[model samples]
Target: MPEIAPLLGETLTSPTAFHAPLHAPHEEDQWWRSSVIYQVYPRSFRDSNGDGTGDLPGITGELARLAELSIDAVWLSPFYTSPQRDGGYDVADYCDVDPRFGTLDDFDALVGRADELGIRVIVDLVPNHCSSDHALFQSALAAPAGSPERAMFIFRDGRGEDGSIPPNNWQSHFGGPAWTRTAAADGAPGQWYLHLFDSSQPDFDWDNPAVRAEFERVLRFWLDRGVGGFRVDVAHALIKAEGLPDWGGRADGGSTEGFPGWEAPMFGQDEVHAIYRRWRAILAEYDGERILCAEASIDPLPRLTDWVRADEMHQAFNFAYLHHPWNAHALRDVISSSLTAFDAVAAPTTWVLSNHDVVRHTSRFGLTDGTPRGGDGIGHGDPQPDLHTGLARARAASLAMFALPGGIYLYQGEELGLPDHTSMPDDARQDPTFARTGGERIGRDGCRVPLPWRADQPSSGFGGADSTAAPWLPQPEGWAGFARDVQAADPDSTLSLYRTALQLRRDLRLGAGSLSWSRPFEQSDVVAFLNGEVLVVLNMGEFAAPLPPGTVIAASTPGAVEDGLLVPDACVWILSTAG
Candidate 1:
């Protein structure tokens, strides 16, 4: 690690960049090679300015909190300039920080401070699409139809006389056609562009060298600004199939819900590999081991690992656990298939239970529908995970994640056992699921509501020191039991569970090996596996299960694993082979 020269300025670099894996001859402390990254959804982290929305400074304010749990890196989701059509996934500018978040200097300070604390910064990099209001989009709109600036996007000629048109049958991620008629006031009115999510976000034309160059510029813009790596968004979708062929006969209600027709020809196509290689080359110029984590969610591990090979991304998220049903046998199946494939390909992978885009884990499992589930709340008793069973479940799940073969990402509020704040009242919705479909999807707002820092106050502890801004989204009543301050002080709190789980991940080399499930604990609802030294057994159910031999190494239930059986409702047993 670089020694800090408090008086120096120009020679300064993010601590992680200077550390650069050179100190450890074999790059041993190159922790991220296999480690846990704590994901912070900025808006809910802390409100230093008391504006109800979290800012970079708020995140900086919480570094000590994270350090206490021993995380390797922090992957911040888009703090760049954006119209936020998809919650900041659409970029308007690559070089500047959004004022709503904080200043560039604030970011630099955050990076420097984190490096000072030995933490790395892996920022979200949105390259596939740009906001409709982006500068280039504006330039393209004002130019001639065939201008090179206009070629930066996929502007197609008008359709046949009937006008049934698109570059392909691909569907947008948010639902709808992937193509939109380009309506540049000064340019051709009949031209079209492809947008895989909101029509406002036009996909870049990878076939255009200039487009690729601009994205490379975007990548360097941050690495130069002190970012350690990137969380490549929609990485697999960065490039579409060459001819934009349709998935013949695989029908569906639309392309968004994975009914199949559009996913194949449009998502994680083999062609995206070239784009990753292109980006990695630019990253290497900054530092040889520059990390790039792909966000591909497709199956058939080889297809996904295509972007995570030795020369490609250092890691690509393995979303099997997130997409699987919350059951023991089901989880075991996905783990077996995924581990086998990922190991065979020699590509590193990662696991994340919750993220800014997914329904909060609590809600995903039907535990949160604005109903009473336990803990200390107004009408409810305590807002915490007060039940013996719920705590066991949460602990087991977290422990299992830590014992996996690669890095694990911890969602912002998972450490506190916070549930999706679904009871925030109707008119206070902040998610597009409700805006776009009139609540057909019930929106992700429930998971995105205000984060509670305390349980003693009306806001459950997350307002200003003088605190009051109505929060960007309403605070869910479920937070009554999971406030940060309350959990921090409680030895038996979920925060404690998280701290223990994360500590174990860092102290053990569980993140660097291969995971292979053994004997298949099918009937027990346990996803059992081996992560190097320890035998990890996860009971997806509330009841306990039998363990093979070794002494219990680390069980989620503080005391759940006694003789051989685990208590029901999420219990984990980490046993040594000797037992």
Candidate 2:
């Protein structure tokens, strides 16, 4: 294989511009309203240096791949300088890149390459917490209780006589107590600091003016470097309620019938909106309609819309749609609710299925129950999913999702029909959730396996043929069959389906169109919707359904329409022939 040439100092141009021609001149600034953003987990996307981990240079090399899929932008997960305690979410420095992923120069090259391909770049911003090794945190550790450094974080005295007990009963999202007692100058247990996640990641004290001002600087630092925007990680959890009161709610936001909703002390505080309003103002100062997207997991679906108010964030993840079961009625309800809620706020709904944080939808849809597994990821001892069934459902789901009126997010490698490494050995797992839970709850490592680009290459071509180390997470042997090269050659493969769907989506202006349930199948297992002249039909029943009245333009399964009947677990896009 050949090395990817350095994009620096090169004359960048879009020779194969796929999306620019499709967008109307008046719609240039509003591209994100109906765009397709590809989420690239930097560690698993591609490795250019033959190192086990993927780097910015590798992502710069793959800009063409995203352009080929008609993607509007690439949303990169955290590649910030970190201790790697929580997959790089534990940020030690907000302004620079980690050595493992490359330097600030490599990041600039990636932004340039993406610009040349007519695609925007959205980098992850983690403001909720910082790595324990961060200079501020380090200074806090060494400073006295009333020092300025300690004021930058949430530090409080322990409750008990010996100060051994935690200040509160709050729990960590990973597991156990959310507070960790730190040693004083004399080396005895002292002030306890709050951490919503692992101990290595301490939650920031948003109440502090310095913390807010620091994040403002960080935001401008990236925006000035030509990044189009940011995907604010844990967007809603940045500000906690006053006094850090203890409550009966689950720390992870899982349902407890008696717990509070939007007013929860730990998350979804009303004060967080002010932070975003300030960030939005900073974004407005820049050109090219820069954006801010929230990764908030607020409940009731409607509450999540608050983050995307007119002057705040431009988009918020539709997690309700992602977690809904595969049932037609349930899916319809989620779509309806999401559209209604987002429309009220005049914001475009951002649709997504699989991301880096959860189990892949392929495996989730394959389960016998046909519902999300929640946090209990599949392990070797767990019941295996039916891959065939899952892939079919996933393909069908993609067609339906593309035809919806909103922005969409595609997780890397889902286009290749990859499933989770459900049988990965326990000893190889690296996710902090797995270790914090003592292996009782399998972590997201299965879905974060490095992508395979070639069938016959080492590590399936993730680190290239000359790679000196194995991938950070082991790739399953069967993954060779799902390599991009293998699927790109098969017209009926999922990769091909995604390409076709994206092309049609662009040509027909489906993302900007309206969606209305095909009246005939509104109450049935067949989900049929009309997007302008296009009619998308998804058959989720056990038997074939009569094909809707239109000419079939594309289908998830080849020959999906047989004898004028649509097969079960299949989806089709139809061109309406009626006047």
Candidate 3:
């Protein structure tokens, strides 16, 4: 390891230093282009009512913490009325908050508070599906096959002579058959409904004008409530292929593949663009720079950019970049491809390290090098990660992400370098994937454990000290070391690293700009790139590398630089005044 040194002094010691506005803010309407949005999974963020579940009020209470982190916005995961079948993604009502999360008034308060703190609010919009218990789905079950109610969802007659077979061989993204047969009003078996995800989340028929108009109303309802934008869940899946053709392959559902079946007949269809175009028009009707961001995993890479056309979504999460191994060459390849592709469509590329659906990057990076995708396969019994090495790379990766052009997303607890609670008990798992896969896959529950706010407080300060309720998901025993309070006090903690990186991201004017790779280093594992005047150098190899010729402005790891040497699994920002 290289010798560590303090790069900045008193500025970092003060809490208010991070809140200072950027030296130059981007254009108002183009805020989404280079914004740093933080994603908060409501169930695990904080519990205000002592119900062991997080709520809107809990998120509202943390606005100051977010504002202090220097993030531009917060993208909250679903808090909509649901049956808890797939977290909150299985929306029972689009316009209402789940009673478990809080009331509509609480949501309104959260939005208001976030706005006051200069942090925009972006709610998750699960437009592709709704809970089976939704009034519309219930009505569709009671109504006849040809009834208009049934037309709202993708309902079709079974194929066999006795109509005993599923409508098609399509499999659920979670696991098992995608089609579920419903009993008719008279109690006889009826048509089958398609659900690409969990059975409780029945897929909507986007071709249906009613479905289109209903979501339009949903968007307006939130927009009227002052939400700045939306994160479109499964954005590439709103429009399936017209004929609902078979994928002509095994029923593995591509669940095991790197692309996660994104190119199948059931996802990423060309018609999806039309739906977004209509949504863009509705968003235009609202003021205050409302935007749409797609959670797309579309393949060929460029297809993800299609959802971000000028009149459609403003940004789409770069899953390709997220899935890349911690290799300098691989990271550079994806970054170049994403920038070129999105630039061609005049859309900003959004970079993300971790989210609710995937294993936390800290844990993911800890594993030995391999092509691992999705969050289902690894868990408590899996091989433990090299936490020391993983965290170093995670910090380095975050700096690299912030140095890139366009927007970025920070998942909750990632700032603390929280790893997946890989030892979580199987009985404690609640993800639909776990139940559906019969414990064959562990699911994403490990990463959803409640965050640690204070080291010694009950529920790790996730809930108030007097509150007796346990966290919905148990915190790992090692969480105390990563507690927000602890990290806040320690200047060298990952939490502090994120604070410094985010502050420097704006102070250096790194977000809104074009990017170009600097000349190669002696080591192939070293990646150096220029974001305006800031030369970002990242060493992913095991040995030290020489830093570019410039003044070191920021470093991801504490000992990232010594005697002009860049240490392994580290990143540094250099101010190239002579360039």
What are the lDDT figures for the candidates, one per model? Answer: 0.67, 0.86, 0.82
Report each candidate's C-alpha RMSD, comma-separated, in the order given.
11.0, 9.1, 5.8
- lDDT tens digits, residue span 187-227, model 3: 78878999988999999999999999899889999998999
User: How well does candidate 1 score on lDDT at residue 337?
Assistant: 65
1 or 2, greater by TM-score: 2
For model 1, residues 300-374, the per-residue Cα lDDT tens digits are: 555666777766788888776676666777776666666556665565457777777765555445542334321
lDDT by residue for model 2 (254-361), tens: 456888566578899999999999999999999998999999888988899999999999999999998978888998888888888888877889999999998888
Arrange candidates by TM-score, highest first: which order?
2, 3, 1
Cα deviation at 556, candidate 2, in Å, is 0.8
C-alpha TM-score for every candidate = 0.85, 0.94, 0.93
- Sorted by lDDT (best first), the order is 2, 3, 1
